[model samples]
Target: MGSCIICGTDVGSGRVCDSHQEDVVFDFRGDSPNGLVPSRFYRGVVDGYAEFGVFVDLVPGVTGLLHRSELDRRLDTLDWEPGDEVFVQVKGVRDNGNVDLGWSIRQAEREFRGVLVQEPAGEHRPDEEPSDDGDDGDTEAETETDESADDDIEVADSVGDGESVDSVGDGESADGDAVEADADPEPTDKDVATDNEESAEVDATLASDGDEDSAVAVNGESDGAADEEVDTDADEETDADRERAPITTLGDAIGESIRIEGEVVGVRQTGGPTVFEVSDETGAVDVAAFVEPGVRAYPDVEVGDAVRVDGEVESHRGDVQVESDGLVLLDGEAAEAVRRRIAEALTDEARPEGLQPLGGDETVAALADDLLDAAEAVRRAVLESRPIVVRHPATADGYVAGAAVERAVLPLIRDEHAKSDAEYHYFTRRPLDEPVYGMDAATNDATRMLQDRDRHDEKLPLFLLVGAGSTTESADGIDLLSVYGVDAVVVDAAVADPETRDAVDTLVSPELADVDGDEGLSTGALVASLASAINDEVRPDLRHLPGASYWTDAPDRYVDLARDAGYDAERVAELREAVALEAYYQSYQDKRELIADLLFSDGGNLAAHVSEQFREKLETEIETADANVATEAVDGVEFALLDTDGYTHRYDFPPTPLLLDDLHRRHADGEPFATVGVGTDELYVRTTADVSVRDVAARAAEIAPTADIDTAGVREGKIEFLSGERDAVEDAVVAAVAEAF
Candidate 1:
């Protein structure tokens, strides 16, 4: 009458069949508490306590508080992980068993909580022999733990995941992860029939009875021929049913570059570790493997189902791993997905240095910082004269950005083209829109406006754009040159991304629009008296001008001249210094001569070289001169002069008033404020109160009543107005004067 959990048979009531009362179960880990906080799992973690110790349950409703004490041992270090499985046995009781469970791990190796396996009896009947499978054929086992699969042993034809290492009872089929704990069927007739009703127990003295060749003698006498054949067949089937261990060396899976084919034995979730046991034609190993992102970026293989990994294998910590350089996918859908993964991985590699991507763990603000910095840098560089030719562009943020680049860059270019005065000065490779460039526009337009450059005497740049594409791209806006109209369009030369910022940048090209118009001069009554200038007035003649350089050189040259004079003093004292100074100047003069000669001769090679060398030298000299100028005093007027309204004088003096007399002389006599009234022969002093004596009073704008300022408008007194309308002029001037004050 023994019905116990250990053997699942009836034992006589009251006494435990297999229990040893002397051993105490000390490891009484109960179910974990309701508040047990489990940490999220990931790779590379050492299972640290990023949190407090949690209570892990071993039995229902009873939790054991996992503490550092769990690692108490002679080793002195708690290096083992909570997930690592170890077997320990209970040896004795502790502290009167009052909640303190002390156990001896050394005594209970097989008696601990694990699969309880029943051992075969010592004695057997005369004809009894266990079946070949060593256990019931239908019985299956499942694992609650993992095993090292590196260089894992592969079955001759195949292998399954999580197979048990040791055989259980006879006739037991191979164990696998799919071997449900309940996969074993109820007592089959085979098992029931094998357990004889003839299993009559004798007295205790008879327990040691049956032994020695009784089975051989009984079978040999009854069926000698038949028994021999049966034994042979049984032996072969038993051999086939034997299970192989599943751990092996990583080296066996790989060698140079041959493909290893096997059916897919494992399929981890995508984006997770790719694991499977691959077998060769004969045997195989369970491989623990992964592809690095660089390999992932360009992977050419399918995983999971079936794969032939044509890669190198390596041993990482005695674990076998497939070191794949690349993969080839045999399946259709899997192949596409692998390619996409590779593409994604590749794109990640191409991100600019120092730019970080948005990892899942990153905060929103951090991502914002990256994006903001990229946009601002590009924008700031372009405006600050140190623009860079970067692939990534500023966002389509139409904020108030500063650039002297014209508000109407297209119309201005068109007008310049009509007058045959447009000349695009090329500044290739470097980015800066300086005064010499005629227009303050992006080099994006420099190409298209090439045809308009006054190449009659000047050589224009023949830009050969280079980049990732084949043929010239369609010139959206940037032309080749003003004179050349548009240079060749090159596509793929510029990197394209899904971001539309490049689109915004491309817009810069079209700002150099086609201009074909007639020449017209500005003419008006007020302009007629001034310098017989263009439009017959005091207007500036700037149509054919090369921009501010024409105006700035007069000032810059004086500084250069002063430099020579200062250096001349030093040179005069030392002949060596004089020679060196002379040589430098002569070299510069010679280089300038070369450039001039090249320009005049139109010698392609000589001109390009001299131009390049001159620019380089000029830039260096300019920088050195700047350092020197930092110490020099500017030549602002000393005792300047006065602008007199014929009566009063206002003196203009240098910023530094080193000499006071220089200021006094400027206000002396009518030499400074001489005024004799023209109409009234009266000599009056011009003071702030003498409104009548002011020049603007004498030139109080007079206009036709028939024509309104609206009809012929311009700015007045720093405001815009037209001579025909008095009211408009008064309003505009009043506004301007108020603003100026």
Candidate 2:
């Protein structure tokens, strides 16, 4: 038998008595599921969620299902996110090694009277005995409770004497009289009013006398001058006690007050407090100050102001935040010093060591300098608490590139900020329907950003464009962002327009690196290397992405890289098909979770399921288009022509561009060949011979003067014309392709 940790009641076999079993929390340290005891509370971390229940990990490799039926509220109403530490009771352990859990009303460790570690050997209280240094093993919860009780007594005593609690203790008077605590009863309203009137009369006499010595003699009678001096000395002593603490070190100082000096990067007004997101050189944290419920606090503290915050550190819903006591804005030399220190630290932390391209692709390696600049820009944005917005084309290669960066930057955001939802707030991936960053996309982005800045006082976001913003066609859109002082970085493998190099802040393109244009590089290959530079800890998760981006003829190095990362060539193909199919359907949505499962999950079930649909849809479209193909000979170069509007499903899967690519591969023979798929107002040109879509459009316009021909997508060789001039435009495009060959 043992005594209970709480209330000292005797127990039959455990540390907790029968009556207090639910009052004490347990930490499961045993290996097997059978070690869990029914009706006993255990701490667990949220592993993941399913339709039926939430999976929680009591220990590594030991998970229990918290069924929805056991919850007091609806499953969807639970605000628990993955990795949160929660409390649940062990309901039962099935014979098949499944442990079932029931919801516990008590969630936090402090809510329980005591805590015990349940191990295979026996149950014991954590650090139960005092150490060699004469320190008791008191948990933080117990210490906080004791401190709170002491503060209540002090507040009560101060109220009885009409003095502030913090100013109660000080040095003795000049005559060697020690100050003693008053044992008088609490003063009534009449007594407080009489004391206030006397203080006001004394203040007026001191101002009228114009004699410092006489005023001091009069003030000393009531101990008013001595009280003022003591308050000043206490304020100075408090300031001296506070050393500048780094934002990253705040977690260790919970329940203790400290001073933090930083710039206010963002300010948000909530229902209870005004939260200021402050960032020092090391990290960023939210400091909340309350005037009243739903009322703004520190109206003078705006974003970009260098300020010092005095607050007690607290943990609110798994996020470490500060409860502000005072906020003082710094200016002149003080503000300059803070700004300089932050700038120096940011530069040192943001600069990467060197560029090591994934798969050792020489084409990407040649652009190391440019890639490093883009990486530095992204890293600095995270450090400064600036949001990052990524825009890419709705294609397999584009999604892979965006997802690679998303996977790398998310962990950094989680580490840099104390908030669990910081990753969702800081990083966003937007997919563009077209391959160009046109005016419509830019206007939408600008409107949303302006609203965020106005409503939440958030900093302007850095726009990262992958696979979509390299050509001159996107110059106007990029220029629009520049007008708002928003920075943009473009990473694409396409042959960029020469003038586009001057449009964006940072441009990473193989063509700009002065390399041969025959590398056949994809956007995913370049951005995956860039993502590695942003955060190298996530490099392993990004190795297979470069190979998965290519539909055909991926480089041997990338294929080998994928193999080493546990992905075979066939698996890479399936992932590519699945992402492409999904990208087409949603086209606009990020599809973050579904895409992550397909690319990162250990099981191949999801990929196989999605890839099967991809193949079935693609093959059906190819078979339909094949029967309508018409062959023609122009200047000894064979051209396959198909009227896409009449023969293909215009609005369904296997989009026109993808279908034309597959049809060209199957029909292209040994001789020089080109495939021209013409629609009502647009046409796509695919050629084996060397050709430029821009040049082809220029030549076709001259051949058919009334057709109004022009290139739509430079990379895809897409040209647009009037519906009435479709026949003329089609004939002219075929003639131009033959002449180029």
Candidate 3:
């Protein structure tokens, strides 16, 4: 008898009980298919290929065919090779004893939770005696030489009627429920322990390199390069080489020989050259090293090593790159000198010279320190050649914040990098379904960045969170980036919690600056000021963005600024409507060119056309919602309740929030009224009075303590509660609004 490792259930001489066996993945230790359990996962290696399918070896003699029909995608696109390891699931044992294998999407070991070692039954335990058949003795003798047994399976180059085979011995049949008596002898306890240890080590090795599709080549091809760097006799020559060549910035030396010093961030192999991505504080450029065709030159060089290079500047494919004539690794005083020089340049160049917020609003002016810090982080990312990923909510205000940053940073990226498409390569703007950075968004971002770094040798991205990622809800997403040493800059106009301050490298918000009436300041306003600090030359173009973000009543300063910039109230409304319409479709794409034209162009043809549609659709939805609102008194407070799902066009351009905003504005009739747009399980509360949605949600919870109410979408004044307790939550919210009034 034996006990299961997971649940401690007594089993009849096996590692796990039959009930818990399928729950854990097993490493098949035996050499035959008779020992493998059906419907189980196993690690296998690609043995060879055939036109019809790929041959996979689970153990030494156990082989199966992964047919082209079972593949999730086209087989021709697979990157697997003969020696690459993959994961597979056993479908069934056929009547002819051939094992049918199923395709697995998770090819890496990290995707599996646990791995157990499986052993044959009734061979070593005291409770179960070994079989006395002479066939068992012969099976053991055959496996001794089975290491070369797979050589007989010829690999066919084209599709033909090739019969698949399994390792089931003569004593086992397709329907055998128990272990066959002629199976190989069971491994000893010590042997099992050793196998488990070895498996663990292999799994750890694979997991450590899981960020890449394959392993990284840290050790370069050349053997004598390390010796050359460490030679004691070369010290004087190295010092003289550093002194002979004058150091120059990559941006300044376009077509001349210049000596530059920086850290090597990435190393990639090309067909004829080894490209080393070198980054100084000023900018990053590719430095090509040529020892011979397809030979890596610097054998000793690795990522994170500081080096000094004397190279001739040349442009490759319209992008500036360096052709290395002489390169040497720096150490001791030389390395420190490079580090200090880069640090000084980062501090000087990260923020714009003589930086100030775009407008003279004192509330925003008070946040200049944090605004400059945020801009500096973004600028540093640009200089370091890291991608900037902007995540914003799918709203007009959110798009405004995201677009402002995109407008300011795109020009700077173009001016700084020699690559013409650097703007597209380095910047991406994604819209969130809601204004919260949860696990799903974080996992997606991390996966993309990791894959980009692994597959293309791209640097990690700088995540710029606009309109979202400020509350405590976003901590998990931010922490995920911190694990990879990626920095996030959070620019929110909401009253963020203090805990968020600790999560991000830079937190820019009016509440953090102790500004009262901070709710009036939108994310667009904050990011507009920040965008100017990033690039002051784009200041004039971003004047209309802040006003466009305010749907109902814009602050007079931004309104007057837009007017002075030739965007009157009607023209500003046109741009606002045009942007709002574009924000709905393809929310994932930034629509950079179209947005730039709408917001920055002096001519109003595009804005006038799109805004005419926006105004028509929005006014129709408002009139429809205004007819459906029912007035009632809750705790003597006037309440206008509208069924948003029934009254508003759910799929229309002007979304529910904008529709509700216009409905309340045009039909309120001068009453201190609270408008509640109730959906199936969510409620949106908008009032002319200054009432806190967070406070109302708290009070609703107090009124119905068992309703399990939550203040979801707090920035939009939305609440989510149990649909069964809809009446109680509505009554409590109305009462809370009365008290606030």
Model 3 lDDT at residue 131: 41
Cα lDDT of model 3 by residue, 510-544, tens digit:
76768765468888888998998898888988887
Candidate 3 weakest lDDT stretch, 10 residues: 197-206
Q: Which portions of model 1 miss their true places by more than 4 Å? A: 1-53, 57-63, 69-93, 96-169, 172-741
| TM-score for each candidate, following the candidate numbering | 0.17, 0.72, 0.65
lDDT of 2 at 95: 95
Best TM-score goes to which candidate?
2
Ranking by TM-score: 2, 3, 1
Candidate 3 stretches with Cα past 4 Å from truth are 1-259, 269-272, 290-300, 310-312, 325-327, 352-355, 456-459, 516-519, 724-728
In order, the Cα lDDT scores of the candidates are: 0.24, 0.79, 0.69
* Model 3 backbone overlap count: 0
Candidate 2 has which clashing residue pairs, if any?
Answer: none
Query: For residues 59-80, what per-residue lDDT tens digits would candidate 1 score against the true structure?
Result: 3443233343433232212333
Index of the highest-lDDT prediction: 2
lDDT winner, 1 or 2:
2
Instruction: Report the C-alpha lDDT of model 2 over 1-741, residue by residue, as the tens digit.
Output: 454555444455556677767767899888988888888889999999999999999988889999999996557557799999999998988999999999886665644555788877667667553233332334557544423322221111111223332232222233544333343324422101111111110111112112222212112112232222222444446554668899999999898878898999999875345789998988889987643334466676789988777668998787899876556667666677778999998899898888899999888888989999999999999988999999998889999999999998898898889887788789889999888999999999999899999998999999999998889879889999999999999999976887887889999988777886447899998899999999999999999999999988899999999999999999999999999999999788888878888888748888988999999999999898989999989999999999999999999998899899989999987689999999999999998877999999999999999989988888777899999998889889989888888
Error of 3 at 225 (Å): 12
